[model samples]
Target: MRPGPSHLDTARAEIIVAEAGHRAAVDYVSRFGKWDARASVRQRPGRRLSGHRDELATPFPPELAPVAAHALVAGRGPDAVREVLTHSLYQYLHFTTELEELAVIPVVAKISRNRSGLDLPEAMRADAFKIYTDEAWHAQFSYDLVRQVERASGIAVRLPELPSFVERLDAVRASLDPAVRGLEALMFSIVSETLISSILADIPHDSRLPKAVRELVRDHAEDEGRHHAYFRQVLHAFWPALSARERRAVGPLLPQVVLAFLEPDYRAIGTALSAAGLAPDEVAQVMAESLPRRRVVDEVAGSAGSAVRYFTEVGALDDPATAEAFEASGLLLGAAR
Candidate 1:
C-alpha cells in the first residue's frame, strides 16, 4: 500500500510526542526522584581520631611515607602548581583506568545477588552505573588534557600503567568475606573520593592550564561530592556491625594508601619537564621542592578534609594521642584556611 503525505505526517507527529515524553521523564528522574531522600539523610559521621592519631604518628620506613610533613609545608610557595598539574594529569589517566576496571566488582556482585532475590534500590543501581560512566569519561578527559598540553607546549608526557590498586582493593574485600563488604565499600568510597576531591579543589583557579581543563576538573569535583556523600552514608549505616579489629585495620590503611598514592615518580616528572624546555637539574630542583607541596594541597583539599570532618562527626578525634599524631602528620596545618 502506498502511504499518502497525511499518513507520513501522522507517523512523524507520534514519534515527536514520544521523544518529548521520554526526555521529560529523564529530566524528572534526574532532578527530583534521585534526590528526594538526600535531605532526610544526615551527613555521614566524621573519621575517628584516636586510632588514626596513633597510626599517623607511628614511625615507618622511609619508603612507606617518603615525603615529610615539614617538607610539604616548606615547599608551598614555589612553582608547585605547574609541576603538580603535569604530574597529576598523568596520574589521573592511570587511576581513571583502574576505577573503570573496579566498576565490574559491584556490577557482578549485584547481579549475582539479584538472581538470588536480593535487590538493590534502583536509585543506588543508577548511581553505580553513573560512576562507571564517569570513570571512563574522566580517563578520556585527562588523556585529552594531557594531549592538549603536549600539543600546546611541544612536550611529551608519557605515563606508565599504574599497578592495579583496584585489584588489590578487591583482594582485600574478598579476604574479609561478604558479610563485611560494607566496610570495604566505605574505605573505597571515603578514601578515594575524598582524596581526589580535595586535590581538585586545591588547584589554583588562576593556573596556566586552559579553561577547558579547569572546567573538566570543576565538573569532576561536583560529581565527587555526590560520591563522597554516598560512601559516608554507607559507612555510617554499617558502622554498628563492624568489629573493633575491622575498624582498627581501616584506620592505619587509610593514611597509608592515601600516602602511597601521593608518591610522585620523579623520573616521569623529569621526562615531562625536559620535554617542556627545562634542563634535567632544573626539573629535579622543582620536583624536590614543589612536588611535595602540591601533593599536600591535593590531599588536603580533596580527601583529607572530608576525612577529618568524618572523624570529627564520628567522635574519633577525641584522644590526645590522636590529636598529636594528626599534628605530627601535618595534614591539618593551615589546610582549611
Candidate 2:
C-alpha cells in the first residue's frame, strides 16, 4: 500500500528554508561548550556526605522512589538507607548514561549520514557530531563515577546483564507499527534526553552529595542544557517533514515511549535493594509498595509534561488518535489507569 502525502509536504520547502539556520543552537554550543568531564575536574576526597547527609537519600523525590517506604527498610537505620538510595543513584545513572551512547548517538548519526533525511543546515549537522562526542564523554564519566563510588563505598554494583530501559525501549519499538518503528527509537531517546537534562541540572546543586558527585553531575548538566535545547530544535524542525500518516503512527507512541523511559525497572530496583542487604521477599515487597501504578503515573506524567507540551505545540497532538493515546497513557485529561 502506498503512504499518503506528508502532513507537512505542502509546507516542507518553506519549513526547511525557515529552519535551516538552527543558528541559536550553533551559537550556544560554540560559546558555552566548556569542560571535559574526564579531564576538567580534579580529584576529591570522594566524601559521601554533601555537607551533613547524602543528597542521594532523596534521589528523584520522596514520593517517587521512596526507598524508605517499607516498614522494615525504613527502620534499616540511616546508614543502610543511604546505601540503598546511593545504589539506586548509581544504577539509575548508569542506565541513563548507557542510553545516551547506545540510543541518542545513533539518532544524530541518522541525520549526519544523510543530508536529505535530515534536511537540516550544515551547522546543525556539525552540531550533531558535537552532540555525539559530548554524549560519549558523558557515558565515560558516568562509568568512571560508578566505579569510583563502588571502590570507595565497597558496594559492588551488581546490575542485571542489560539495563531494563534498553529492554523496555526494544519492547516499545517492537510494539510500534512497522511504518513508524524506526521513528520510535529516535523519538524515545530524544524524549529521555529531556528528562535526564532536568535531573542533571539540579543534582549538582545538592550539597548533601559528595563533592566529586556534584561536580560530575554539574559537568554533565552543563552539556545537557545545550542538548536539551538542541533536541527541542530538532523536534521543531523535524515534525513538519513527517506525513500525516507518519504523525498518526508516531504520535500515539509518544506516551508509550515516555512511560517506558520514566518508569524505573522494579526488578533492577529489587536487585539493587537486595544487594544492599534486604532479602528477596523484602525487596519484592518494597518494590511492590513503593511504585504503585498511580504513583508511577503521577511521577511519570509530571516529569513528562514539558515533552508532552512540546509535542502538542509542534502539532503532533493535532490528531485524535494521538490525543487519545496521550489521554490513555495518563498524559492528557482523564487518562487511563
Candidate 3:
C-alpha cells in the first residue's frame, strides 16, 4: 500500500534536510576542521600560565556539580576544587572518546555496511565516513589533552569502572531483550552525540580554564556541531525504518542513556571528595543535603531535553512501556500526553 501524504511529505523533507546537512559537514571539514594536533598547537599558541592562583577554576559547569562547591568539598580550597574539577573533566572527556570509539563509530559503520548502498544512501554513507574519521581524531586529541593537563598540573588521574557510560549502558542492555540490544546501543550513542552538542558551549568559553584546554574543547565542539546535524538527520531516517516493538524498546533506553551521561557519578564524586580530604560523614551529608537529587534530575532532563523530544516525535514515547520506563528512571515524569 502507498504511504499517506504525510508520510510522503516527511520523507521528502528528510531527503532535503539530509542533503543540506551532508553538504554542511563537508564544508566544515574542508573549511575549518583541524586534522592535526601539532598544527592546532602551532596555530593556537602561547598557552603559558600566569602566576595567579585565582586564574584556575572549575572546568565543567558548576551548576552540574553543586555538591562540589558546597563547604564539604570546595572548603578544602582552590587546589582541592581544581583537583576534583580536573578529575571530573578528565574522566568525562575520556568517556566521551571511548563512547565515540566503541559505541558510535561502530554503529554507524555497521549500519552503513549492512544496509545496501541504496538503502543507506550515498550522502549519509559519505558523511558517516567523514564522521568516523573525525571522531577518531577527536578521541586521539582528547587523550593527548589529558596527558598535557596531567603533566602541567601534576595531578594523576584515575576513575572507577562500573558507572562509566559504556558500563552503565551495558548493564541496561543486559536487562533488555537480546534482539533490541543493538538498538539500545545505537540510541544511547545518539544521546551521547546530542548531549555533547549542548555542552560544547559550557567548557570552551570558561576563561578560568587554560587557553589550550579551552581551545581543545572549542575545536571539538565545532566538529561535533557538524556531527550533531548529521545524526539528527540520521534520526530522521532511522525511526521510520523500525518496527513498532523496536521503537518501544528504544524508548525505555533513552532516559537511561541521558542519565548515564548527564547524571553526576556520586561514586566518583564521593571518591574525589575523599581524595580532597573530606570526612566520610561530610561526603554523605553533602550528597544528601547540599545537592538535591530532584534538582540533578531536572538538570539532566534539561541537558538531554532535545534528544527526549526527538524520541517522542519518533513515536518512542507513545508506547506505554517506554513511558513507564522513563518515569521509573526518574528522568521524565508526566511527559506522556
Per-prediction TM-score, please? 0.55, 0.80, 0.78
lDDT of each: 0.44, 0.65, 0.63
Best by lDDT: 2
lDDT of 2 by residue, 239-281 (tens): 7656666777778778878877777777777777886689887
Q: Which digits, one per residue and each the tens of the lDDT, describe model 1 over residues 1-337?
A: 0111111221121111221121101110122234334311221221122222222222111221232222442255223334434444555555555554554335424422432111223444445555555555555565565565545533245555543454456665665545434555545644565454433564326344344545566656655666666555433322322344444445444444444344344555565455445656666665676556666545444446666566545544454554555555555543353
Provide the lowest-lDDT 10-residue window in model 1. Answer: 19-28
**What's the alpha carbon RMSD for model 1?**
16.8
Instruction: Provide the lowest-lDDT 10-residue window in model 3.
Output: 1-10
lDDT of 2: 0.65
Steric clash pairs (candidate 2) = 6-243, 7-243, 7-244, 50-208, 55-208
In terms of TM-score, the best-performing candidate is 2
What are the RMSD figures for all models against the true structure?
A: 16.8, 6.3, 6.8
Candidate 2 wrong stretches, greater than 4 Å? 1-64, 196-198, 333-337
Query: Where does candidate 3 stray beyond 4 Å?
Result: 1-61, 112-118, 161-163, 196-198, 327-337
Ranking of all predicted structures according to TM-score, beginning with the best and ending with the worst: 2, 3, 1
